[model samples]
Target chain A: MSHTVRDKAKLLARVRRMKGQMEAVERSLEAEAPCGDVLQLLASIRGALAGLTGEVIEGHLHEHVVHAENDAERDKAAAELADVLRTYIR
Target chain B: MSHTVRDKAKLLARVRRMKGQMEAVERSLEAEAPCGDVLQLLASIRGALAGLTGEVIEGHLHEHVVHAENDAERDKAAAELADVLRTYIR
Candidate 1:
């Protein structure tokens, strides 16, 4: 089975929670809550989505890159990941 | 200024790198690289995208939630973030 399939239940749970947070943001907007409140809600939702993305990334790393059998493959994976990280963190 | 606006150049550079990684994945597939190689490339791309998501999340947390003017707003933001995290990490 694919790693994602193995972790489907857990990943779906996160997505569901993110959906709920998004709904709350929508409701806040509809209710004309303070702009500050709405912004806070949006920030929370963004963080939730980020968490979900991070989980998937971690799973991919463990399943694909970290476990590769050969040094060349591992080096390629590490280099690609490093390059992206340098850009991402900036 | 909007946090994203202030950091637009940096964010765009990351996005461009992610785009390149995605293209590399595509090329690997086209060239009939090993499945493991393709998977590793995909994993790297996913990690890059996740990194971008994380940056956005961090910026939102700092700009919107952390800096809110009142206790009530902060509490609300914290609660929402906590709720989402409870599900996200599972």
Candidate 2:
């Protein structure tokens, strides 16, 4: 998306941070950390993933749902949104 | 937690799967996939993380909140739950 290209740097930053978080989770497992500690780390990763998801979704909604110029484009956007939501909610 | 020991294998499996999903996200970025594809990958990761979080949270509630031995124990559990919820929400 055009919007995505503009946000690519920020998005990639988020991706890298998430990668670090994932590795932390793996390290915790390998070290046999306490369950409470592991749960907290997983929760942090979950929060980061949610933030990233929200960023992309906000962009999608702004570009498609809110700004579609034609009826067909709007329909396509709505359909894609539904599809994404279906997967997201799972 | 005692409950965690019982479920360690299952929990580790979830962690590993989430790690794989995350690597897919990085791969998609490296391949210059469409924004839509990247977003789909993110959504899937979110779903998996949520699943794993739910599993751990369930165990925590069952072991601590539900089966707490005394008021003091229950209160501690509640406080920890609150801390985790706050972090998860952010």
Candidate 3:
């Protein structure tokens, strides 16, 4: 199994927390919270997602890229990662 | 300004590296690099994107979430962040 799958339980916990956060956002909106308040919440949610993404990415790198046995393999991994990064960031 | 905008140059530089990495992936595919090699490359690319996402997230948290002056604001920020995190990880 992929490293992410191996760590599914931990990841799922994080996901659950994220869900709770979203629910809070809904609650705030329903209550007609200030725009600044809502915006702050949104920004936090985005950050959490980013953190989760980073963790998964780090696992993949350790399992597939950094640990690769050959130079060609490592180089290839780096290239593929770079391409995806471009699309993701944009 | 959002911290990301202020640090655009550094972010862009990283983006450029990601582009270069993608180019390498394309070249490898064209040259018939082994399947294992290609998979490794893809994994790396994903990781790199994750890294970039993390950076942006950190910036947002620092500027908008952590720096908020009130407890209510902080809670809202955290909640919103959690929600987005759920969507992102899935």
Candidate 4:
């Protein structure tokens, strides 16, 4: 968490760009752009999501999984990461 | 494209929800919410994106691939879809 806080600005920026991409998708649909155009927008949105997600996962790995004070803490962090991955990578 | 046009409202609705979810992500960071909470939000966003992407892909399959007037049209559609998928499934 502390680690993520350290990188909060950068991560938030990624999220904001992604948000903007979503707005573009909305606009494209409203304008009834071609399906190819919408698909291109979706590709970018997904890329942004993957970028943000990767950063978060990396921070967790460094903070809780690798740098945890004890085995119990490490296991908990790993489990939580695994659980999130289950939901995320779907 | 006509297939997507028919489903425009529904697809736009999905994009709007995803946009709202992205805003929540922004708020969570601005409030400095815990990483766990942010990860949960990311999971939901990814799910919503996958759902929308699936629908679009299906529509393309019906319009450009399965229902194409000729082999040339089907090939072009498949190629475009493949290109999008290459970027998307990253």
Give me the candidate number with maximum lDDT. Answer: 4
TM-score of chain A of 2: 0.84
- Native contact recovery (fnat) for each candidate is 0.00, 0.47, 0.00, 0.67
Q: What lDDT tens digits, residue by residue, belong to model 4 across residues B1-90? A: 466788889988899999999999999988888777788799889889988998898898889788998999899888889989887654
Write down the worst ten-residue block by lDDT for model 3 chain B.
B29-38
Off by over 4 Å in 2: A64-74, A86-90, B66-74, B86-90
Q: What is the interface RMSD of candidate 1, in Å?
A: 8.9
- Cα deviation at B13, candidate 3, in Å, is 35
Model 1: residue A52 alpha-carbon error in angstroms: 14
Assign candidate 4 its CAPRI class.
Answer: medium
Model 1 CA lDDT for position A4 = 57
* lDDT, candidate 3, B7-54, per-residue tens: 656655554565555555455545545434444554564565567656
Give the range of the ten consecutive residues with the poorest summed lDDT in model 1 chain A.
Answer: A29-38
Q: How close to the true structure is residue B17 of candidate 2, measured as C-alpha lDDT?
A: 86
Q: Supply the TM-score of chain A against the true chain A for every candidate structure.
A: 0.71, 0.84, 0.73, 0.86
User: Which parts of model 3 have CA positions greater than 4 angstroms off?
Assistant: A68-80, A87-90, B1-90
Residue-level lDDT tens digits of model 3 in A1-90: 555556656665665565565565555545545434444555565566567656756765776588877888678766766654575565
Compute the lDDT of residue A3 as modeled in candidate 3.
Answer: 59
lDDT of each residue in A1-90, candidate 1, tens digit only: 445566656654554565465456445544545444444555565565456545655655675578866887678666655654564455
Q: Which ten residues in a row have the lowest lDDT in candidate 2 chain A?
A: A29-38
- Per-residue alpha-carbon lDDT of model 2 for A1-90, expressed as tens digits? 556667777877788898888788777766666556767888788778878888877877788678877778778777777778887554
Of the candidates numbered 2 and 3, which has the greater lDDT value? 2
Worst 10 residues of 4 chain B by lDDT: B1-10
Q: Determine the backbone clash count of candidate 2.
A: 0
Q: Quick one: best DockQ, which candidate?
A: 4
